[model samples]
Structures are given as C-alpha cells and as structure tokens.
Target: MAANALLKTQSPTFASPNSALDNIVLEYSISYFLIDLLHYLIFFPTDILFILHHLATLYVFLTCRYIIHHGAFAFFMLLILAEVTSLCQNIWTLAGFRRADLPAAAKLYEFLSPPFYALYTLVRGILGPLLVYKMVVFYLSGVAENLIPRWAWVSWMFVIITAILVSIVWVFDHWVDWFKGRNYKAAKKVV
Candidate 1:
C-alpha cells in the first residue's frame, strides 16, 4: 500500500493531451538528443587524452588567473572558457562511461532509485546553495549598504573554522580507513 501510494505520487500523468501536441513534444525531444550527441562529438576529445587535457587546462587557467592581474573582462572571459571546457569534459566523461559499459548511466539512475524523495534531496542539495549564493551576490552588488552584518561575519568565520576542522577529521578518518581497511569496513557498516 505504501509503495503503491509512492508510485502514484511520483508518476507523471498525461491527461489526454492532443495527438498533435504529443507529436510536437516527441519531435522536440528527438532533436534535443541529436544536438546533444553532435555537441559531444564535436566538443569533447577521446577518453584518456581528454582527461589529460582537462587537467592541464585547469592547471594552466588556475595558475594564470592567480599570477596575472587580469581585469574583470579578462576574468569573465576565463570563466566562460572554464565553463565550456567543463561542459565538454562532462560530455567526454559520459561518453567514456557509456563506451566502457561500466554501469555509468545505471550509477546515475541508482543515485535516486528510491524515487521522488531521493530525487528531491539530490536536486535540493546540489542547487540550493548555488541559487542562494547567486541571489545573495546579485543583491549585495546592487546595494551599497553591507547586507551582511558584523556579527554575521563573525558567524561566518566560525562556520569556516568548523568546516576546516570537519575536513581535517574526515581526512584523518579516511587515512585511518586506508591503513586499517578494518576501519573502512566498520565505517561502511555504520553507514
């Protein structure tokens, strides 16, 4: 009964859409898929070579950005380049996974296999911070007055410290797990 209710809540229903509209939607989907494949082929390099180039590109970009006193326009251009490269890298990754037949697509599907709640959580976690930060930055830039209070700055400092401490702890834990392997098994068991 619970599973049935879950399925009902999750499943999409087409409430008698006209045949013409349905055909249009199908045509759009096919076009989108073809375009995606074309982009993948044209933009992305093959597997190992692409990985090496991706890493090299990232290193060069970061090094140059850090060393050079580029204007905002230059920074923006670099950001755009980074975005395009990243997109191409992702496409190459997906293609490599597909060619390897290493359950690449299945792994993505499995991430939200439990359905609606799992999908919701995944989307929320990924997009929530991104949307919030974009809005905050936009608003902060527009308004001259400091939106974040002095106290809020202190709170942020604390959060940063806590994050650093947590990361350190995680690194130590992972190191211990690697050394013992028993600890790794125990950690997985706890999870």
Candidate 2:
C-alpha cells in the first residue's frame, strides 16, 4: 500500500494505463484469491455471496492483468478505493465476535462502527452506482478496447454489474437499521 500510494503521488499514469503488472494489483489479486480459498473451505454455504464476490474480483484482476489490456488505471483506482476501509471492517467484525467478554474491545468497536458505516455507504453505496454508470459508458464507448476474449470481457462486466446490484440492495437494507441505532449486532453475519 505504501508503494501504491507512493506511485500514485510520484508517478501519474492517468493518460496511459500501464500494461505492466502493478505491485498493488498483484498483491490484491493474491489476497483475494487466498480469501476466496479460505472462505470456500471454511464457510462454504454460510458466506456464499462473499465467496462469489471474492471469486469474481479475482477473476476480474487476473483477466485485467493477463488478458484485457484496457482500463488498468481505472481498475486499480477502483480497487484501491474499494479496499480503503477493509481494515476497519475486519476489526469491526472481529470485535463483534469477541466483544461479549471484552469491554474495551466492545467500546472500541462501538466508537469505530459509525465511521465504518459512513465509509461503507460512501464507497460501496454511492460510488458503486457511479461505477455502474461508468461501466455502461465505457461499454458503449468501446468494449473492444479491452482486447480480451469476448467471453472474458462479457463475464467480467456481468460480475461487476451483479456486484453493484448486490451492493445497492445491501446498502438499502442496512441504512435504515444503521440510522435506527440497531447495528449489525443482531444482523446476518457477512463473513
């Protein structure tokens, strides 16, 4: 992440999306695959949506790196933005599981929950809809520029669209509850 941030600050690749492998993208791809693997083995049906999301993310990154040749800059930026609150999400969930006996941990989770929800809504809710719009624009502009096999491009776009739809629904489902002061404490586990 430090390297990715440094590169973003020092080296602008806006006009020309590099075809070379970015360390950050590579790292994220590996991490997502590992997460998918673990979830597939451990949770299976319990968190099938997350497992599918992870798989789709891994597929998108792998295809972007190896097959598709367009939109690295946009993809990397989206990936970074999407993961900005990952640490907070992990900590919040872990705190939930352990908070039953740890008063300090519960206090910390409570303090962090509001900010986490805010960030989640901003990125996964608002930005996600914007991304779906961009996807449409990009497709209409020229899906051919992607240069990958037709099946790969189609599947990637399909995954993204479905993910965005899921995110929108999830956000709407949770927003009222969040505002009502009933947090995920009793909600379905995301896993």
RMSD (Å) per prediction: 22.1, 6.1
Each model's backbone clash number: 0, 0
Off by over 4 Å in 2: 1-18, 43-45, 146-150, 180-191
Model 2 TM-score on a 0 to 1 scale: 0.72
Q: Write the per-residue lDDT of candidate 2 for residues 1-191, one digit (tens) a residue.
A: 53464355433432134434464555566676777679676866677778778778877777666555444555566666677868988998889778899998888877887888788888877886686567656655654444445575567668877887787676676567666656455454543
Collision pairs in model 2 = none
**Ten-residue stretch with the least lDDT total in model 2:** 10-19
Model 1 C-alpha lDDT per residue in residues 1-191, reported as the tens digit of each score: 21222233322211111133333333343354455545545766454433443343333323222332111222122233233334434554465456546676645533322342233233333333343344345434533124334343233333323433443453356445445755666889999
lDDT of each: 0.36, 0.66
Q: Which 10-residue window in model 1 sums to the lowest lDDT?
A: 9-18
Candidate 1, which segments miss by more than 4 Å at Cα? 1-148, 182-191
